[model samples]
Target: MPAICKLARQRLHWLGLSVCLLTLAPEAAHSQDMREVRRTVRYLTSRHLHGRGYTHHGDQRAAAFLARQFKSLGLVPFKSAAAYTQPFPLTVNTFPGRLAVTVDGHKLQPGQDFILAPESAGGRFTASVVYFDSLALGQEGARQQFLAQPLQAVALVLTQPDYQRIQAQPLLAQKLGEARALVILVPGKLTASLAPRQVAQPKLLVAAPAWPHAARQITLVLDACLQENYRTQNVLGYIPGTARLDSLLVVTAHYDHLGELGRHHFFPGANDNASGTSMLLQLARHLSQPSHRLRYTVVFIGFSGEEAGLLGSRYFTAHPLFPLDKVRFLLNLDLVGTGDTGATVVNGTLHPKEYQLLQQLNTGPASVGPLSARGRAANSDHFPFSEAGVPAFFLYTRGGIAAYHDVDDRAETLPLTRYNELFQLLSQFLTHLAH
Candidate 1:
């Protein structure tokens, strides 16, 4: 028998799984877990979870599910934690129901035809449409005259550029907020995000082609609520090391997504984060095996409120379950569903030695290339950890579906092209960390 297999068998003999381990090759054993990974992604993105957002308590449900997973894996909760969950509060704007839109008597689909701005307020209005271009709204005098009219009688429809300009001009934006509603025509995809507060009036983003050229009237029925003190949590657990237990290696991913865009429209977020969360879970599963235990403690964190601007990770850094300084290295994974062209390591340029090690470790069919490197970014759960002086890298796959922050980012559409390759790379990297 090979030395590696013999070592693994000896370690696993205590659990009485040596025969089972020796029967399957390493690659086969790893590949078997891919089924579980896909199932996890699908379950997290399922309609019952409500896009895993704030609506219908999807995030809360997800947290509970992850806690169960941790317990089953034999990961221990921090002694100071609230039983594997670190709870926090956030205020968010949510569209729970009553989403209807019609332009010139043509009822449009929720995700296809339009999307409310994240901060849009609830309102019902049927009024005349007044279209405005950049040139028409350029002069301050024209905006003043427009705001002077009976705002309730009109829903101002502005070109995308004009809408952006008005938003930048706070005085004009506040004045325009008094109108029945602001309809902005987007020439491309309609992306959505989370918001902490609601605006004075509803802002509707209509696909340019969906809007009739000579539309006379518009009707909007939206129900929005500014949910204050919304309770959410960061799910975390850890495996103690056999040797350097005081030092740590952390893996993190955010499980919260854009959630539902009303009653019917939901962002599945398969790639944006479900993929990363799956990787975190998979890594935890691998490390928890008796034969795979490492020298440094491995901490796994499935953060919430990432869509709300990394609130969960920020809170953890501020009120950490373990000493922040003890974290030897941290890897933050996000948007890793595809790898046709390769992947990029954010903050790689900042840590050249570690980047070189990662590049060196990835080889054969498992290599993600052209493995690129990037500088610092505040784009993922890694930002807070890096800010807290933890050596960190945010890794994400590249060259696949462009669906992001939309209703189309479903599990069915996610390619997961190089999931196995990425998983191998992570496992190898973790092993190297022990030395």
Candidate 2:
């Protein structure tokens, strides 16, 4: 399948006339720089970075690395800042220690067979299992009987669907706090995330197939901590425009992910935003070149705290170093690792002119696939800028590996199918912006 996709991309590459032939800039003639992108992705996914999350100072390490990259690229810091760093505060719940689970005397591996809920609290216990279905919860008597289970002595096991159903009901979800722990059997990939606050109840998410169907007892030991006022930073730099130095064009990608789960396990987050961050670095490198400099200042921002609810971007929007009105356009990239089928542009419908411009540049068979226009969405770093009245678009490539927010989204598996094509498309788009 990988070979087939590579062949298709090669065919697509030959079908389109080079944008350079259309009298674009000299930089448009450069070949796709896949080596740098791959290197960047590999480094970002390395375990040394601790999954770029809140624990182990992962986000801070990433920020420092980006600052060094910006300096090496010859990009300058935002106006008046001592360096290319904008520090901010974040409060997040993190799991940084032992995360063990045992079912019916069978020990399970962390991250592979199970993951703790993002907001789950720490606990060490062996509890008797009480399996329940959604239908059982519907009955008043059964509900009361279940809620009456002795705390610290019982563990409630529910299917993913039943868990979702209970979560939807505030009363039932709160009542669940009475149990010693909650176990959710997920039939699919084990996803991880960040939580703003830690809850009192401990929760375990086990792979459905890994859970013993007739299990009677369970043992779990989770060590979690909630950090307050954790100081992190956003990495920012820019290339000065040749002509309109005051007006700005901005590019952003979050560099944070669901950091380390424990001392030994971490989420690689290759496709999550590492791909986007690497692309942003490439953009910075491209624009910083003398030949590719545009008419307006081009700012590249590697935002942290995105996995913690877009905190970095929200802080920047609230206390913008430069005047917000000076920003002509902003493009936020995430999940750009794969492009087997197509891509989507958030807020495309709200700004038809920009969307149409992308469409014009995306003509020819060389384009990856369909470029779907979507309405306003508060899904990425673009949302705060869009809400502040700056024209912004959140772009993400689709269709490749199913790995996401899980342990499997590693650099080894990222296909980067349409990376070169999308890079070329954006280069042309920037050339048009120069006019």
Candidate 3:
């Protein structure tokens, strides 16, 4: 077995044993205290949250719920803002109209069989089909050769593992224009459950058609367009500092996830994000108390449009309430609910001092290790801040549960056994940073 997977499995076994012992022990009070984190995780990862994406009311509702929590925790706005919402604009494509696709005299049902590209220009075209295998590889030349043929027709592309490379190549679209060929993607056996009736934007590897003659009598009809004028907001809350207020410590987590595909499957995103957001809220509750004064102001940010590509954090850095230079450190929490064994801290190697401090705080007999550490990598909300020359770290737990980025990442399955320890470690780290 691979080393990482082996380590993960071993850790999982340890965590399972720990949970069993905790349940059997007479320390019900400790278990009950930990239930708060579990309950919050479940609530946020519930079906009602709709994956916390922009397509549904999930993002807005989550923002409101978080703002309420911030208010209850006594976190006031940093400046003149009335509330905790840091509104921003995001351009997104939405399917508000109709989509149609027809192949070889048969009309294909939307969402049931095929979906059009979001940027596709709606049109009806009768032409032959041309097959190009692996258009991103030597297929580019092969595609040119096919187009050079006397016949104009629909083009069938058999994409390989280089899906992103194919998508990036402008030659595909340019070839379609030159050959006047309609594009038909022959995706493998369409599983009813996984297939969308009408995909907002279809990007998938397709199998090559059986016969070359099958291309001669191809006809396709597609109706699709891009919507450009949509916007989303990120929620922000802060507790002002007392001494040396000019410096800042920011806590961030993305609250967005993949929205509902149709009606049935919602990527609950419990651990993908909602878990981290819950931790942020809990930490805000603890630190926002009047007694917890610090040298640097603490800003808690709940970013949106993260699944869409780190939009919220990018926007915040671009138009920061406090000068970006004044920001001393950003600690981004993500995927912390299921870390019964331990958690991994990204960018830990980049900031050895902070990493050592975290390890020291979590070094008790019952606590989980600092886990693995890696140098700076632009993977999450911490990316933008780090790019802007701010010291930042992305912290997440490792092992315990395997659920991630799927519907199974539900709140009910999260074992938040180490939450109190994690929180304590964070509190200590913040104190150390403050000094």
lDDT of 2 by residue, 359-394 (tens): 988878789688999999889999999999999999
Alpha-carbon shift of residue 314 in model 1 (angstroms): 0.8
The better-scoring model by TM-score among 1 and 2 is: 1
| lDDT accuracy of residue 150 in candidate 2 | 60
Pairs of residues clashing in candidate 2: none
Model 3 bad stretches (over 4 Å): 1-29, 94-159, 162-227, 290-295, 400-403, 415-417
Q: lDDT of model 1 at residue 208?
A: 89
> Which of candidates 1 and 3 is the stronger one according to lDDT?
1
lDDT of 1 by residue, 1-435 (tens): 267445533433422242234224334565556766777888778776788888888898778778877776788999887779999998889988889998889998888888888999988878898766454367767766766666666888887877777777777777677778888899889888899999888988888899888798988889998989899999999999989999999999999998887798788899989999989888887888788899999999999999999999999999999999998889999999999999999999988988889999887766876789999999999999999899999999999898989888889989999898898899889889876
Provide the overall lDDT of each model, using Cα atoms, as 2-decimal numbers: 0.85, 0.84, 0.64
Clashing pairs in model 3, backbone N/Cα/C closer than 3 A: 110-197, 111-196, 111-197, 111-198, 112-197, 128-153, 128-154, 129-215, 343-397
In candidate 3, what are the lDDT values of residues 1-435, reduced to their tens digit? 267446534543543444344335423365554655565566566656666765556677677767766765667775744488877766544333334444556554443344333333444556555555564345657667744654343444433333344556675544444444334454443211111123322332223342233434545444433334335678887787888788889999888776553344456777778888877876776566556667778888999877667888998888887788988788998887767668888888988888887787777665665477888877789999999988898988887777665546677777665777777788778867877
Query: CA lDDT of 14 in candidate 2?
Result: 35
Greater TM-score among 2 and 3 belongs to: 2
